[model samples]
Target: MSEASLLKTQVVTLRVPNELKSRLEQQAKSQGVSLNNLANYLLTTQLSQLETLSGIEQRLRGRNLNDLKQKIAFLLNKVPHNPDLPEWDRL
Candidate 1:
């Protein structure tokens, strides 16, 4: 956990399938970016997505599912049905 270790970038070699690698290379070429840059973009955003999902799970950890369901039902019932869309009443 030293500062130098944190700042260092190590090369990683992945054994990806040939077809996937070819597709990634083609996409990077079409976008006028280096394959490395494209891979970096994908890896960084995928991690970001996991971070966002973790944040959502953390925020909802203490929520009660039954209470949420009841609240949603109450809110749905309170909404006035449009006369033009009578199907809403059946739903």
Candidate 2:
């Protein structure tokens, strides 16, 4: 199946205050586009930014897990209950 076909579309009903609605319509008209197209364009831009941020977060999370694993391994390999002799720090 095509990528577009795999994605489903849904309609959303939003209630905007009159002033904001008027501004959006005015902005759309000034840009020579339909109100729906303008809204969709704005949403697409914002969603793209969020998607990029999410990908970055996923990458960082993977690195954090690896770091935690390394720390755990280091701790596990330490000597068991070794005495902290005063001379060790007497330099």
Candidate 3:
């Protein structure tokens, strides 16, 4: 055994939907790895991606007004314009 493998690790108790657990088990079996290993790999990879995106977001914050407005406009254009609505739905 390697030194890294011998290092102490904390246990985390996670509650997942039965269907999701079954899918994860199937994936782990197909990859010839234990469920714990697969979950660790997925969590580590996703956290890295989120950290990268967060860095980009922080750097872009309060940097561009026109660009942000254009992006918002582009998104707003994708929504269908409808004035007809029930009184309860009107803001």
Best by lDDT: 1
Clashes of each: 0, 0, 0
Question: RMSD in angstroms, candidate 1?
Answer: 5.9
Better of 1 and 2 by TM-score: 1
| RMSD (Cα, Å) of model 3 | 10.4
**Which candidate number maximizes TM-score?**
1
What's the TM-score of each model vs. the native?
0.64, 0.55, 0.63
TM-score of candidate 3 versus the correct structure, residues matched by position: 0.63
- Kindly list the per-residue Cα lDDT of model 2 for residues 3-54, writing each as its tens digit: 9985767889889999998999999999999998899998999999999999
TM-score of 1: 0.64
Residue-level lDDT of model 1, residues 1-91, one tens digit each, is 9998977887999999999999999999999999998999999999999999999999879999899899999999999877787675577
Candidate 3 wrong stretches, greater than 4 Å = 1-6, 65-91
Indicate the TM-score of model 2.
0.55
Residue 55's lDDT within candidate 2 is 93
User: In model 2, where do residues sit more than 4 Å from their true spots?
Assistant: 1-9, 62-91
Give all candidates' CA lDDT scores. Answer: 0.93, 0.86, 0.93
For residue 81, give model 1's deviation from the true position in Å: 12
